[model samples]
Target: MKNNINIPKEKLNQAVSRGIEKGRQEKPMKIRNSSMIIKRVASVVVIGGISLGLTFPVVVQAFPNIESAIIDFVESVLPKSYSNKLKHESKKNNIVISDGKAIVTLENSTLDNYQFIANMIIESDFFKQYEESDLEHNLYANLEVSIGDNKNIVGWGAHIRKIDDNKASLVVTADVGDIKLEDNVDVYIKLQGLEIQSNEWKSNDIKELKGNWDFSFKTDKVESIKRINIKDEIELDGKTMTLESIEVTPLASYIKLTADENISDKWVFASYKIVDNNGKAYRNAQIDGHTDEKAWNFTIAIYDDLSNIESLKITPYTDEQSIPSKIHGQDIIKMTTTMDEGSEVEDIIVSRPVEKRDLNVDAKPAHKYEGEKISYNLNIDKEKKFYTIDELIGKSINTGDGTSVTIKDITVNDKNTTIMLKVNGDYNVLSQVVLFDEDMRDIYSGIYVTHKGKWPSNSHWNNAKDTHYASGLATFIIDKIDVNKKYKLAVPIQKEINLNSGHTMNINLK
Candidate 1:
């Protein structure tokens, strides 16, 4: 069976020549390795006691007869949720094929109604010739796996574990495209060459380690596919948006929305989620794409049974706001002060129904300005439902510059709570703000202050302003707060950009 697998003549010749050298060696060759480095700030600090409960109603059952070797490999590589699903749905498939230099063993595969996964191991003595320079973003960046005729299935994700210094096991997954699989039809599995990312993280180098690693398997048809289409209209802030369709399957729910051509103001939503009739909340809502100038699409992964949901109520943001940006790190100030750990300062009170202004601030060139003086009683246990009060200012340190962020006032009304802030020195300092409980533990960390207007489409707040100061609001949905309990706020002194290497994958089942 191995002799029948096809390999390009050049790759076969290279493998044979390398094999001759391996035949004479006393032991396998070793390659010097340089691992990838990732830099990120801790988003959440799990302090003592306080915990937020996030739950989904999915029932997971273990799949019997899985190979112990493959189960161990899969658990090591994939995410906990994905690994659990794979374990429950996988079937054992023991198939081995080699191309003289590297041996690949297919251990198990899972075929869900909408997804497919393959688990395998690759043992290659030839890999020793390449050193750390041949490594990619991590390890496995070059490993390729596919299924169906003509390599129709490209892998969506892969988890790899190096067993020894030379061999590795990989689990690859794909979202089986829109095309339905036929019963007993041949499903071809193929492993292609590997790519290595250079120092610049670009795929400029590829190792042509080719082989005839192929297998044929039969698949029984799946019956769990389900979908629903609903054309519903939703109104927000006097603007109308249409929910064109809602698709529900075992894995996810897809929602489509479109705007009317006559509408002038475009709407965007944040903290959006669907609550079913049973009061269970699902917050997996993600913006998939903007279909056109007037339309948008989204996807929400549903882990529970679709039938368990009778109706859904969705929360959408109606009000949009914008703030301009300012220059940073110029004429920086420094100050050191001492205060009681939990002290009460001063407060300026305003009348009820304070003047509400539209969030759209006009764009202008950056300028330095002395912001208005703000003061507030540092009281966290005010029982007033709404506080029209003076700003509670905090000093932040950024690159030797002391910037000030003032919480102008606090409003607790309805289910939405907003924190209005004025940036006196620099807007970048407010990039990270955390609400900490008494023990210096986080109640909410990594809170992003987003604008509603069209100026700053990018995620950065600095793009919205070129001035010396800016003001914006961060809104959150909560039922009620325990104001009696003490809390503290923390913000970064300098601007920070969390480094992220973006890699994309496309899945087309059809």
Candidate 2:
């Protein structure tokens, strides 16, 4: 084959050189004939064999079996760890275990029912082992298992297998809504890597289990029984009564009660009493009640005497008969009573005075009247009437001259009415003369007395020596007066007098 191939190559090269020489002989008439000859020779060698090998090199074409080729390619491209993992997964897919009855259904005709059944068995076992290894100590004890999206089981279905002496593997399958367990129990579930969404949790007996619970996701509602376990013994009037449902919240210290009517209207006609464990009447126990529409709500603070009140008795009075009902052994009680027609309840709280005591007992001094020297005399032994200094001052009257006239030795009903006058050292003239009663009203005129005294000059009065004249007759009518009561008497004295040369005088009455 090599000799034949080399022979074709040599003959092709000779044919090319002959064609070039023929071209050169035919084109000898031109001056470029020699250059054309040389060019033809180089082209023949290059295109004929040596350059053909350098440009279009040889390539061997051989193929192995198709299956083995694919396998080898896959193995060569993938990492050793990944390749081993795929092999392990393929082996795991073949081995199947079912924790419960495996239900297989084909909704779409494209899916193979047998293949789905196998897949579910594998998934169930995987979840079972996962839950057993993960959540053994959780409070939720029961377990259920299911496979695929089917309605074969309406409720929870679970299966268990013995794993060890003390522990067991469990598989659970249930819907994502409305799941509940019995009291004091918990349920743990694993659905491969699927998430669950639920709303409510409820139990029949909250007292036994204690209404305390924890949840992982937000739910719509949870119901549980709240128990009031009495710490101390209480006396009940009856065996049992329908208790009003009260909303009890977690971690709250006090119990709250709501009513449908005004508390005053409901409790007013109902006589209620609360006694503590010691059986003492509570004092100042506050009872507050409010009204909402036709209903009454009341809150009563419990005290120590009212403290630990294990019993409460209520009595209602009616026209037909008196009905007495008792609610016993409850810290918080709520009830309603009807009000009588045309009758109303009144506030029963009363006001009382707080006690106080007196402490001091000392006397104060009397007040002195402000005036110049004035005189007064009283003769109660002779008159059987009262006379005070104010009455004497009322009898005095001012004269136009520098002197004033006053009654002397005035008597009323045999009582001596004495009088005295106060003359300032600067007073030099008098204005008018009139006698006034104790009320300061003019009762008599002292004109006659002033005219009788006559205007006397300081020189002519040298021998007078500030003398006072008195008359034994009654000078002014007087009315009965009380000594304890204060009275004012007005007497007009000197007016507008120039008394640069001051002089003093005195007048007396007896």
Candidate 3:
């Protein structure tokens, strides 16, 4: 599969070797597992497109003045791997503006329906005194968008490359939904508050610097786009999930998915990939938003050439709903007692859980707890793999909200505890599952599988499974559970509507 792509020969050889080694080490997987593995490798190949030598089509179209030196600027701002993927061409609109403390020169900008990307240069006394690392911690570009009379602050990220003691080049970007140029709209950006103070990277850290350098621009041109509708549905377990449409813009691709209304079982459509006629696949980069009731919108960064994209494949995920039963201890017997400095085992009585029951909300057991507390005593000489759980228990939980989740089972050992969850509500419950001790500090669980660009990290537990179509198990880990201390499993409450307001200013540039 690597040989089929246009990447360099040496990289292809490396990829093939890695794929083969990975395939050999994996436990027995489904028949289609090989195909999925190949697709994953293909996506990685798309990211390393520096040597592919494909011309930057959209970037070239917009930014004609992009020089070879810009490559160095890009490398300074982004990760070394992403320096090569920066857009070089864009719709050239060299608009410049300033706010006394700094001067900004907007060299070019482009709009891809969903997002706005701009190329600009900044000259300021505030930036001249800082090093690249200092600038990274201190500098930021604040952006605001106004469509007709509807104005609001937008979320944005920027990359800055220092050009000299007082100047730097930048690429600022923001995702603005459902943009229509026909509406009188304007974008305003400012570079201010340049100061450096660092500890750990906190999301809500406060800033103290006060330098006001601003730039504002508007575009009258709108690319004519036609969205393609592919209303397709996949059904399983008496539920239906639908793929509503695919919007392929010049910059990226968008997919719309909707779960059938009023369905009880949580449907996860995890697999969203675009396959070209040549079999090259593109993975999703970020989510746009939830467009309607039980509907989601997502975007894919089409970094690779998209001349031959044929269709989008939406695969259904498999569900794991039952827990495994216990096994006998004597059937797995091996011995070698580890003697502590002054301790010795006179007689060993191996014990296991004699009873199990499913639990409901409020910690009520569905059945009476019979016999001893569920446990297993291990033998020292036996390999850890040989020691297995002798009892399994499940529980059902209501998330205070209307949603409810089922704790299909739990297994604990000296090393870690694994909790398997099955959401029985209309929404995906995996992202909402939080495990905390009585003190309420968030515990860090080992990341088994995390989908890139997921809003909350580890939102999708099974990358191999089609998450949107089926409910897959979520496994959480903790070193050990204390029988005396209280533990709670919860999904923090989220506001359905934002009621807070922010400051806004209307500045006119002559």
Give a tens-digit lDDT track for model 1, residues 125-212. 6455443212112243243333455455432444444433344566555444333566433456656644332322223644455556
Which is the leading candidate under lDDT?
3
User: How many residue pairs collide in each prediction?
Assistant: 17, 24, 16
- Per-residue lDDT for 57 in model 1? 8
Please give each candidate's TM-score. Answer: 0.41, 0.13, 0.43
Give the runs in model 1 whose Cα sits over 4 Å from its true position.
1-85, 88-90, 126-137, 141-155, 183-186, 202-208, 233-300, 304-310, 314-510
Q: Show model 2 residue runs off by greater than 4 Å.
A: 1-272, 276-284, 305-510
Please provide, for model 3 over 250-285, each residue's C-alpha lDDT reduced to its tens digit, 9 standing for 90 to 100. Answer: 555555555544433333324233344444433344
Of the pair 1 and 2, which is ahead by TM-score? Answer: 1
Clashes of 2: 24
Model 3, global lDDT: 0.37
Residue 31: error of model 2 in Å? 99
Question: Relative to the unseen true structure, what is the Cα RMSD of model 1?
Answer: 19.3
Which of the two candidates, 2 or 3, achieves a greater TM-score against the reference? 3
Clashes of 3: 16
- Cα error, residue 441 of model 3, in Å, equals 34
